[model samples]
Target: MVATGKKLSLDLRVIELHTQTKLAGYIKLLQNNMRKLFFGSKINGVMALYC
Candidate 1:
């Protein structure tokens, strides 16, 4: 019974680590999207002025 409890604890730790990694990946994706959006708008504005 004690061994089973220890195994469960190890599994929980692994899951928590995975969750943290996934969260970081999501944050990076969001940052990239925001950067692209800002850059896209700037380019659009310049094009409008030239056109």
Candidate 2:
């Protein structure tokens, strides 16, 4: 049981890491789009909230 629990926790960690990386990539993409749309202006409140 302990081994299974450990394995499950490890799997969860891996999944969390994957999700974080995916989110980071999406944020970067959105930032790029915002920059293009705003002519390199800072990300505003609405865009920040979306990210």
lDDT of each: 1.00, 0.89
Off by over 4 Å in 1: none
Model 2 clashing residue pairs (backbone): none
Off by over 4 Å in 2: 40-51
lDDT of 1 by residue, 1-51 (tens): 999999999999999999999999999999999999999999999999999
Residue range 1-51, candidate 2, lDDT tens digits:
999999999999999999999999999999998778786454565677888
Clashes counted in candidate 2 amount to 0
Q: Between which residue pairs do clashes occur in model 1?
A: none
lDDT of 2 at 46: 67
Clash tally, candidates in order? 0, 0
| Worst ten in a row by lDDT for model 2 | 39-48
What's the residue-level lDDT of 22 in candidate 2?
A: 100
